[model samples]
Target: MNRGKLNGVAGTTGALCAVVLLGNVMAPDAHAQNSVTLYGVVDAGVTYTSNAGGSNQYALTSGNMGANRWGLRGSEDLGGGLSTIFTLESGFTIANGKFGQNGTFFGRQAFVGLSGSWGAVTLGRQYASSSQFVGPLASGSSWAAPGMGYGTHPADLDNLNSTNRINNSIKFASANYNGLTFGGLYSLGGVAGDFSRNQIYSLAIGYTQGPVKLALGYLNVRNPNYSFWGNKANDSTTASNITSPVIAGYASANTQQVIAAGTSYAIGSATLGAVYSNVRFSGLGATPVAGLSSTAAAYRGSATFNNGELNAKYQVSPALLVGAAFDYMKGNGAGQGGVIYRQFNLGADYFLSKATDFYAVAVFQNASGVDSRGVRAVAAITGATPSTSSSQTVVTAGIRHLF
Candidate 1:
């Protein structure tokens, strides 16, 4: 999903080769009982959007229903209820066999850690705490991989869609204690002489008893433009599917913070969920150009976004599942006084087999007030281009397979 140059030479064949090599190298040990697993999902679809850059368009896309990815997970038993674990995952677009996540081989995740009765401690690039605990309860994450953006709060300002990952991080996830669990994370900016340059910290707590689930999470970032993903300022290579006019120009912020909570309940064959999130961007700035006053020039001073979502899903049969979600976003700040966004998402999936399915989804969104560009706030779906008007619609049909 990154905007980096696609390595045309390393196509699907190369990926397959890498998978095979890794599997062979990590073959399970019979005596030790240590194990390694290889898994993946492939999804593709045809899509139509009511508006994209002032034109109605139809196209072939990857990850509409789920992200296309393959990964390796392994664990080594070290006796006494202790174990060492690791995971390496990568995402790619099947349409042109291009790597995703800014073209990193293990962009989705890359981590190694130790686990015991108490908890697990992991090190490496990984999901932020908010992304780990809160995102799961969001309607956007219910569908599957490459989660639908329509269910994400406008522009994903709250990190509910796993938009960014942290680097140089240490994470701790406590063992579930009678359906209660908690975790935390800290990422070092790795900038010597300035410990606070691009640091990040997060905490999350959750509980699940029976069919009820709840979670509360918080995340704070220093220099979001550089800390979120350890990317350089104004770097075009890190772009993903999240290019929305709603947040495109506000990335250069001195700090960003988010607090979110979610809960879900199951009744009969249906599950209902609700989520709320508040996000603040303080001291936003424009990229430094000629003779700019630090990186805070063009400062928007500060901004805030509040979002709410209600969603539900029903299982009508062994092979069919249907769901719907409604999301609302309210934005206010020095530059955005009345910006608001409303979105609706509906989807269905028909299971062809345990590891394969056919799916269809549709989304409609409307925007009101003005945007950062001082233009009318136009509808901008997560994975599609922004509309020239106040409303936009997107529909897609796709197939997915797992291995």
Candidate 2:
């Protein structure tokens, strides 16, 4: 249950329409030795933003807590203690037709893999470790959508610019060993003379036993230039990191990295979870402006952030579920410094069948950053950012189906 999802109007929308009608492989028609499945979420909602820059903006949005998308997945057994598995997932928007991430075909996921008791090794595009640990443990990821402040510190920061999925990468995930499982992923740069640039690596560990669940992860990305997605600077009350500025631009401290930890507990029909994250940004490769000393450049820039969250959910009934979440984040030194954001999210869903469901939700934010005017988030897919005001809100409703 990660915060960010892979289905949106990012370009694959055309394909999504065609695939939806095909229906996940025709339901294994008579005399067929092969089978495949199609699935998707059709979530559309009317949103109302309170105090949206002095005007209440009301509009329809998609992919709030979860993205609106359709996909195809299938597998065939080789009959030799092995199987061939593959998934081709695409993302689109019901509200509008726009390709996610600049028109990618399979922005959600496109991969094939071999699986067995020795764990699983997969290839192609897939989810990142950040989403595996930090995301589900936080409130914004589970509850905060478009209506709240951007999100927790790092606000899916580990998602790598909302790119929870990696391309041209090889991944390995081991089966649970007593209560621990590990995963690692690497992406080959595929470019000449830039072995380090554009390469990504992630390490993650997960544990589950009885009523306790826990996760820890680390991610590092080498960006040749500055990108808010990878090279974010985190600061504290007393000092600033020279590499990351609140505003966007290219900087020399091009390397980005993060460390995170999270935990959860389940008791009967209810469960509780919490997470803490420390994010840092550094300009190890930066060259200050001419005549500007490193010490001077350090003052105007730098970022250190602390993010914390608490979450809980109740089964309530066999066909219904309800949940609530709260999150907080603060930045120091940069434009976001003294930036404090508090978020609240509440929602419920009811299932009509095993494969169909409907849901409704609301998100609110109160903050002291960005001049106390507060910013409103109407869509979850735009990703999280600092708030512009001290208060904001968003409301949503939609439907989903699976096959």
Q: Give me candidate 2's TM-score against the actual structure.
A: 0.75
RMSD of each: 5.6, 8.0
Instruction: Please write out the lDDT profile of model 1 over residues 28-124, one tens digit for every residue.
Output: 4523537656677888999899999999999998877778887767777999999988888888888999887768778888999999999999999
Clashes of each: 5, 23
Alpha-carbon TM-score of each model against the true structure: 0.88, 0.75
Assess candidate 1 and give its TM-score to the true structure.
0.88
Name the lDDT of candidate 1: 0.79
Error of 1 at 97 (Å): 0.4
**Residue 133's C-alpha lDDT in candidate 1?**
89
